[model samples]
Target: MSELTVRSMTEIEFGQWYSSLVRAYADEQVAAGNWSAENALQMARQSNETLLPDGFATAGMLFLKGELHDGTAIGVLWIGLTHPRGIADCAFLYDIEVESAHRGAGYGRKLLAAGEDVVRRHGVSALELNVFGDNDRARRLYQSSGYRVITQQMRKTLTDER
Candidate 1:
């Protein structure tokens, strides 16, 4: 297993790395036809906005950076707090990606552990995420990391031209 250091993203440090995450996901999702390129960057813009933390922007939100044995960030996990569910807060996870070569090195697990530690300090009792049903690997990771399916939301595609 490679060594990892998880830390909060700085305002100046997030631009390039975070953009790569968004672009990579956008390219793949568009190529797979899961999303439309027809939105003219609006979808991406909105996602970027919501992904960044606002209320507890410093310690409450963070990125997981994994280093090679020699030190390089081959993985990143963007994490934040979701809207409170009951009296406890929920951790919202996104932008979690491990480089193709580094996926099995347990970096993702370390990131989740780090996220749990951070949120727990703030008195959170549970973590929640909305992952697409098609992402089996992610579903497994989240489940393995101790997340349970509280609910499933279904969406119907609108055929009428917008």
Candidate 2:
């Protein structure tokens, strides 16, 4: 694995990536009976637009270009913000998705650092994000970075209700 580069995503490129990534994830989730793709496309479009253009929001996308020795675009992280919610001034997250081969290379830490700076600059008093309970690796990263689990959101998928 070669060095990974993290950069601010241009509006066009990030829009492309955001849509593609969500659609891919949506397809998989629907097939797995985890979610309904009923509104996937609409949601993806809305998310892409809102996520990138929100003046109060920013996302740091990571990629390994030349380092993609295997001829693949490896992702390092995805840190961004969502609309604010109760008790939280705003929501921020260290959505670190390091390329499989680059895990443990400190990309998580770097991405968190960058995202925190973004959140602080926006005048958010508290940073908040949700993490999968089963994701021990991600939990460790957040915990080490001074983020704790404030709450857990749970839902049960209902299928065949028709």
Candidate 3:
């Protein structure tokens, strides 16, 4: 495996990161039946606007890019510092994505480990992330990395009856 490095994203990389994030979110929304493909893009835009009004500049947010030692971009991560009502301050991973071409090369694991290091350096002792139930690959990665489920949500569709 090649060396993986995570660095704060530069302005030049923001556009790519934002675009990818939006597309990923939209895809998830469609898969979850929250939005139709025809409107997913628009809904994604509006949701992002509401959630990240300041974009990557939002307070407590950290945007990072992952690359190989040879300078090949492999992934992007978005983390946010959070203080839940009963727990110490911790880091929440909002998004983590390894490019499709780079998948299965261990880049995802490396990138996540690097993210842990980055958050730990900031004095945070815990990290949290949410993975959709259908993303088995990602769920496996997170599980192997020592993340256990703290909570889960399930949904089902029922036939309409008049």
Question: Against the true structure, whose TM-score is highest?
Answer: 3
Give the range of the ten consecutive residues with the poorest summed lDDT in model 3.
Answer: 81-90
Encode model 3's per-residue lDDT on 10-63: one tens digit a residue. 877977789978898999999988899999999999987776778867777789
Q: Which parts of model 2 have CA positions greater than 4 angstroms off?
A: 1-7, 24-33, 36-82, 86-88, 154-162
Off by over 4 Å in 3: 83-87, 160-162
Candidate 1 least-lDDT 10 residues: 51-60
Q: Which residue pairs in candidate 3 collide?
A: none
RMSD per model, one decimal: 4.4, 5.9, 2.1
lDDT winner: 3
Model 1 scores a C-alpha lDDT of: 0.67
Over 1-162, each residue of candidate 1 has an lDDT whose tens digit, in order, gives 656666655555576576676676676667556678876256666666665545225455666564555767666667665553432466777667777877776777776676677667767777676677778888888898888898986667689798
lDDT of 2 by residue, 87-123 (tens): 5466555244555775687766655655566556657
**Which candidate model has the greater TM-score, 2 or 3?**
3
